[model samples]
Target: MEPIGHQTGRLAAFDSLRSNVAGTLYEAGDPGYAELATPWNVAVRTSPAAVLEAATADDVVQAVRFAAANGLAVAVQATGHGIASDLDGALLVHTRQLAGCTVDPGGWARTGAGVTWKTVLAACADHGLAGLCGSSPGVSVAGYTSGGGIGPVARTFGAASDRVRSFDVVTGDGRLRHVTAKSEPDLFWGLRGGKSSLGIITTTEFSLLPLPYIYAGALFFGTDSVADVTAAWSQWCPTLPPEATTSLGLMQLPPMPGVPEPLAGKFTVAVRYVYTGNADDGARWLAPMRAAGAPLIDAVQTMPYSMIGLVHSDPEDAMPASEASCLLTDFSADAAETLVGAVGPETGSPQLLVEVRQFGGALSAEPEIASALCHRDAAFGLYSVGVAAPPELPAVADHAAGVQSAMNAWQFGASLPNFSAGGGAAGFAASYTPDVLARLSGLAAHYDPDSLFRLGQVPAR
Candidate 1:
């Protein structure tokens, strides 16, 4: 079978594609094709030969089969948050129409690929249940979990993929499989950390926590106090138990609405923390940081679990952005000094946000069902983001490189999938070990012999 040519807008197999699926199909020049094909990262221009707005798992199966038959590669997108590169004339499967979400009071959730953490958070709030959600609840549950989601409460609960019960996916071979630890175990393990490398996830089911509330929020200190506050935080993290999750970010927030006046248009350090324990104990654990320095805004307090979104308060609006990331073996005081000197106020960095998130506790331990998720013992996650624009974007990458160079001594040499979105083959390669990548590539060969899933973050190719 010859590989599909670079044909855009129309195809010889359009009739069969339309007949086999209930979802709408669009060519490049079609009225809705632009909107349907656009990704969350405006930086990536996806120009697929065809787009399928999948309405069902069966629709996904049909789309894969169609791509296989036509000798075309296939790509999957839910919220487009993980768009790595432009899809050049491939078949794009958009799972926006698979909006199914159901929660059991017994502390479990099942969601279609279209469902986001916001939807799951809202639904589960009614039952005092909480799903492991990343900073931005707007991200798709399936997409996030598939990439081994590292959420705000990750120190306590571990990665979202660790909590997964099962996944209903359409593999590259055109089969709709119901996968679990006991059934199709290899597929189950591969799908968890492989992202969309193995298949298009149609629906996902995962376990949830039953806490009604948490003692969580952010403590903001002015840049003038960055030195003092950072020192306190660096010293405090080592003493934290598994129930206490925390991170510190240096923010360069614009003076927009919802942005506090103190932090807007100014350099500030935000110490974000979440405690799963009781209020008194949580406060006792957090007391030193509260007294670290005179905070401009101290919002840390006991709040309902439903308000968990406020802890990180990540940007919800979709816009173009560039990011770089790496894990750390340890964050020593010397590393802290190196980081502050690298991207702090003195550096005049163009990047919008720089973060050093603590990792330990439950994150270091593997779950009962082991998976392909790697870098479990990483001590911290260091990431940076900048506005992606015509002239300034290049500087972001350069500046990020300089920062990583400054902290090279503590580098863990790997990163989580959620943070490696725009990273190329090297970035993707750093995400897993040679053994895991080899296993994933082997599985991709067996499950996707034609390399139909080449467009995802997977380095299967």
Candidate 2:
């Protein structure tokens, strides 16, 4: 892995790129090699031939052009929160330094690709507004939006991509372009769900809703109540109005400092909530779920939108993680029984968390604009996460696969881009319909005839 030496003819072109871009370019032996190549998902080791810490949009264009000219592929990452593949000879463009954000109180915000959800949330908070953010605010806004972000409020507000107004991107073509519903409609449609497969998103402009406060948080129940609570939630969610969105989690929390005393080192059930309506009505709506089981901690309460993270507190630190997810068409009583029998509290599931987010209402409604995002009709999404490469990893991944297999009867559509790994091109195809995938491939070919951005999950032409 010595810095792609002179023996390779591409070195000369790579060297020229190093001289032109304002960014720092590092090869295999560089001091930053270890740090730049490391991703948030530490399971897959990334071994890019060169790393470019792009300082400006121009630098991104230059890097793509160089990679294209030198017969090298390109891959882009900001926080590396959702890396799906290991980068081998691909030139990795680290977008962490492209930070910039602007909040237009009228209704929207524009952010650089590197900007995280917290940045937009804070800026929108100044205007008593909120962006459609994920469980954790640490995820990059563009990356999250591009992957059709689904969160606690997804059933109420729909995917983050649905709220997007525009995107500034560097396509695989080595050209920078602006994309939106009206201009470059095909690119706009593809970028909304196509993600980095088509290009590296430089910046994204999206709508922010007027949500000052919300009735949101999680209600924790003990292991004794897991069966009762999960069963009730499965039936109850289908009846929920559009204003309320919810998810249920089966968690086995370590007895760490942040762990609530009652839930420490125990298998517990948590019903996460997010209500975008009147507080009193929201409470009344949640009564059925609250009455499902005697909650260990009745933490759900009305709070400012800024505190929404309390509902589904994703980890703040980067760790080695492997996840599997799929959209479900139904969670019938029989399915629920099967799930509980397999991975419920008594079974001692190995993963850190098993979650099912109810999807319908606004999420099922098609966006006004035609975009590549598909599978809106799915009723729910199931996901599992655990440490990768740990001693128990093999068993954990196996158990997760078993859980997935058990739910096959309820699985309606493909896995989400943000949650799926393996299957590569097939995974991308599964995320959308055949027509949408074909359209995306056409756009990619038109924008990037050279196909420099084909390192990971790009649509096959």
Candidate 3:
């Protein structure tokens, strides 16, 4: 909500911003300020001087121009899945009112900044089309695609950024422009993964996949069989074809309303999978994982693409959370042992979830048009998340560090942008190589010479 007793900006400044835009503006203590300023992660706080609930792209341009003239920084939030702690003393652009999605039977779709994956999926289902979507269907398409989104069918369809057709964006210099591979080559490359570094995107269009339906879901087992299941997964992933995408998660679930009866208030391991190919081949390939250990719930089977969100079943409600992640060099036998010893059932771990996903299929290959997104050759991704209250944040942060340190031998020296949300410059350095970062900095200076696009993990030259 509103910061304790600290007021917002000066009345004159608020008046100036209000006069510049047609959308509604709320200062810190205003009626709608609290609702507009609150973010999804309660553990992370945002105290903006003012919030602009932009009604259209024209409002976005006006807000940018106002921030530039006032010498104030700017930050953007849609669904708030990726908001960081950099919103202080800045003007926030709220894009929730920019929602729309239209799918053409010609194999392409266009959406506004506020559209979510769930909306796109529903629209595409009527045409027997599938769009690349992340685990959580509620996150905005702009936020996910800006961070180089990885989805349930990532191995088969590749990253969401690779399929983007064009972007309508407003750079920090207060200019709205269209970005495409052939038109604005540098901005097109930088925006796909650089995210909030060069501009604020207003709309994005991308290609869609043909044919619906997929064989996907998760097999749940008690934590007692974690070691056995992990070992089997390590051996089985190498044998899988590009049509299959899979991950293994060690879960410590709290007894909540939506959690299943078998997994509530218990420790468990889930082997989640998705296959885009025919059902017969998918079942044949997934048989060994099902036989690895007797599952409490054998929920893996063929399902329509419209029901894809059932595969991961990510949390939809907002909660206080702290997360840490790294790319893995390998998932060897010793690596499995390291994972168990660090955050396993007997380790007295504090994290709610620890997961590792297999990579390297179409994900490793370059798209015909390349962007700044990197780490394509990374073998696997290791991520851990802890529930955090305001007072217990230090312990959660330290425990995540310890988990990352425990598997230092297997680290790939890079991280994924979507997962490394709050990590600032250090995480930015880890995600991109020296060359890409250098190019991003060069482009940032050329496009945003005033350095107004200063949010998120932008590389500093």
Candidate 4:
């Protein structure tokens, strides 16, 4: 997609950007421009006319103002883990150089747009604190929170955006503003779940969980019990209390060194659990899942909070990926059967991992104020992920979508922001209800009257 036919003359502003920022300015001829513009998903081919590596928040302000003055659009990217569309011809603000992190032992931390979850997790661990990290800690914190971060502990703690204290953003009008619940209320509410359609977030502050250690990990089961174990887990999860968070995954892992001996080169079922309460209670809560089937690996145990990656152990390497997410009100008996029958062990599923996380607990409760995030009352979150570059990967993504559509009768109102991909305006709009979208639209109009930040995931005016 080109720049909507309005990128006529931005030479003067682009010249100013090249002269002001300490970071490198990459144009069409730059060697690294192509690689840097591409996203982790790889499906969308981002082709920014010029890429500005923002060394500080001021650079972001300059970039936005330059885009506005020159009639060019603006887009933001950190790790590219969540890009939904090609940033074609937009002035891409690369936040990688704005890396800054400060952890306070008082159970909170402030970070720059370029900071990733892994860095925050390590910093918080030093003070016996924990940041609400997703399955893969490599994703950027600002990007994750901008999408209402639904992670492993989502059921217990709710969305990561709920803990946000403030956001330092560069509005499309070329202004740097500090936004919070009390200041710029609409922007504050919209930014929490609106992604990047409204403005460019340069820094954010969020509260941390007081979890220094947790009884969390996954228990892998062989294919023979995949159906039985999955059905059992499905029934068992609804009865879990607020302290216990759980999800089940159907995986077709290829034989690889990092993969355990029993799991690789075959299909398997993994019952992942995270108990934020006492260790003894966590163990008691996991007993049913442990007894569900003969396990290949039982890695669930009390471990340091920083070791939370053991629960899912999502791939760390960059690769082409395709993903989809939906909310389910409840997985009834019929729904459970439908899910298992469609993707059961004997079905020869091609997905790398098909996961269903039991939601409720804190997730069902609303934040103190209204926000753009929708479908909080859904009973579960169904997500599908598969490699997209390999020859067989297309089939895998299709099968995963099939499994998801099989449960469409129970599909909730919208998709979760974290799991949405390349949705563009329609996709981002799906994450919110009509009212929330309206409010976000109003804020976008007020702050970005020129409509510069309309790439993906931001509600349209």
Candidate 5:
């Protein structure tokens, strides 16, 4: 079937979809179309042919079937944290109404596409269990895991995708199927890191970690100590073991409501740490860095796993943001010095945060059943984020690129799928190896022959 264009005929065809699905459907200029289609980044705009606030898995199936029969593309959004396309002339299945989360005390969880990490964290905490969630717990569990979620405790537990047991998904052909390693090996491997390429996941079930508390938080140092802290962190990271996960950030926070008095409207350095071992040993291991400089805020301590978001304190509200990232071969002292010279306190950088996260340990280990998440050997990951208002957008993008260029010496020339959002097709291609990308493309052809989800983060055949 030929793809539908933006015309009155396409709008009239959606009338059949509205009656078939048990959900609300909105067309362009509808009361809630703009609000439902908007994403959390607020930087990229999306205008789908229609939006379906899916009430159940059947709703997703109906939407996909409608798109297939009517010659329209298909896209899915939950929290919209990682939207990369404008989704023009597509049928957007918004899964916010698919809120179902059930945690089994036996150490596994089943969450609907709409459920966020915050909900899962709280539910699992009741049983002294924890799910591997990204820095911000506000993101959708299915969406984050679909991109091979790397989180605060990644070094200890590995990516969230590594723990997934199965997925209830609707493929491009509009058939609902249960996907697992044994049931459909190829789809199982691709869906974990391929995002929405092969199907729209309606539910995800994954194993959870035991224990409810850990030694985790961030230590903040003022501008005067930024150099010393960065150097110490660089030296200290190489000596750490698998039980510890950490990242160092060069922050230039604006004076705002959530900003602390000491850190607001100032340049500072943050040493974010999460140690899953004994509290004493975690503190002892952190002593060398603590002694590096006089910290303005020493907030590191033993905290409940449910409160994990405090380690990074990523903003929960929607705002315009420009983000860029790349993997690093190694973060040597020279690399650390170069980073400080570029985006540190003295550089007059416009970026709100430039961070380098240590990667390895369990994160580098291949799962028993492999996934499409590549770049496991990267030594570290570098990311930069800046507020992107209309006037400042150009400056933010340029400065972020300059930072990436400045660190080219240690760059590994690849990025994590979760961090490569909004980078377009080239960025998406960089997340995988040539062979892995080829495999995904082949699977896309087998599962979605019509390329219904091609407008998403999927690679072209």
Candidate 6:
């Protein structure tokens, strides 16, 4: 391969890459450069030296090879829901064109990097199979699973990463390899939760649960009952079986399109539940919380597995938002009280939503194959989100940090990779234990000798 021009000659040199790739390539100021470079999080401004909308797995290989040979770093994006960096001066490979979804009724599915969980969920629903998808089915499967996917049913099943069977990836050295537990154990272990620290996944194959339906939905409570409902939820979580998963969210929804009339322009609390067991038993188990206060909307009922996204009702559209999260060792009564006092209704909290999801149960079990995912032992996970334009961005960020500080007593000092994006290296390091971090760092050095992925969420050496 011929070496491209460097630095001052970089703009013209990208022409060579365009010729080598079957996909469309966009340089800075190119006609489609802005569109291809934009991420789902509108707040992050990505200005890559070039953008290659990868049309095939080979396009990824070419991008990697070109970047490696040209002394440019490479970054990968699917739906851009988890963009952690601006990707300035890098070679951005957009995989949106690699849309492919194939489901085997025999209890597994294979999807392209660009495929979202919505596609897989629809395909799997046909055969009474369910993929372990995150709260938002709109997120890319490869991207979510790559970060150790935790979802509404995570407590009943394990994380989506725990279900992964293999990945077709392009490593930093520009090699396309099929990675599985037996074929490439190290890569398999790292890729499951390392989130693009080692390579760019072209496709992913994973097991699917034989779940036709689940008794699940959200129970919304009025502001007057927020405290009682949250306190009940905190006390109720400990009694739930592994077959049941639950979370509570304190929401301050703005009156807007899609926002329900009862929940719009007011503070509310939502008790989200998903039970894989008998519907009758599920309802019986949820009785205590149901009696905590009169529900403004009781949408809980037996529903087809494809409708799982209703449990959380995460926004389907892209918007500018700030997020903060931490794991909790416990959510005792005192912790619950503290949380209510901090971000509950009438607390002057600026957050759009603050949630605490119950952990443990199947989620705490050791996966048959060990992966880089850690902090499974945490009892709960706390996350907060706020939508703000640039002017309000700083206040939103500061408020998010304040919410975390309010719950510091119960924090586990760690977090899940899926919820911890844009944290830079220190934030990435906080997600793993020292040994795990050291292992990931060492593997990154070996696989990415030139530190091509060093710019974003990957751990530092």
The 0-to-1 C-alpha lDDT of every candidate, in the order given, reads: 0.87, 0.84, 0.86, 0.83, 0.91, 0.89
Per-residue alpha-carbon lDDT of model 6 for 1-461, expressed as tens digits? Answer: 33444655685577777888889998888898898888887888888888999999999999888888778888888888777688878999899889999999899999999999999989988899999999999999999999899899989898999999999999888889999999989989999889878889999999999999999999999999988888888889989999999999999999999999999999999999999999999999999988999999999999999999989989977778888889999998889899999998778988899999998998899899999999999999999988989678779889888888989899899988888785667777788888987888888888888778776456556
Every candidate's CA RMSD = 1.7, 2.1, 2.7, 2.6, 1.3, 1.5
Candidate number of the best lDDT: 5
Cα lDDT tens digits for candidate 1, 1-461:
33456343345577568988999999888999998888887766779888899889999999998888887889888888888778887899999899999999998999999999999999988899999998889989999999898878889999899999999998889898899999999999988888888999999999999988999999999988887777788889999988999989988898989999999999999999999999899999999998988899989998888788898898877677878899988888888888889888888988789899999889889878888899999999999988767467777888898998899999998988888877876777788999999998888888887889987655656
Candidate 6 accuracy as lDDT: 0.89
Worst 10-residue lDDT window for candidate 1 reads 1-10
Where model 2 places Cα greater than 4 Å from the true spot, the runs are 1-12, 388-391
Residue 247 displacement in candidate 6 (angstroms) = 0.7
Candidate 4: regions farther than 4 A off: 1-13, 390-397, 457-460
Q: In candidate 3, residue 411 scores what lDDT?
A: 93
Q: How many residue pairs clash in each candidate?
A: 0, 0, 0, 1, 0, 0
- Candidate 4 per-residue lDDT over residues 276-345, each given as its tens digit: 9888999988898889899999999999888888789988776777677788988777777787788777
TM-score of 4: 0.94
Which regions of candidate 1 deviate over 4 angstroms? 1-9
The order by descending lDDT is 5, 6, 1, 3, 2, 4
Every model's TM-score: 0.97, 0.96, 0.97, 0.94, 0.98, 0.97
List of clashing residue pairs for candidate 1: none
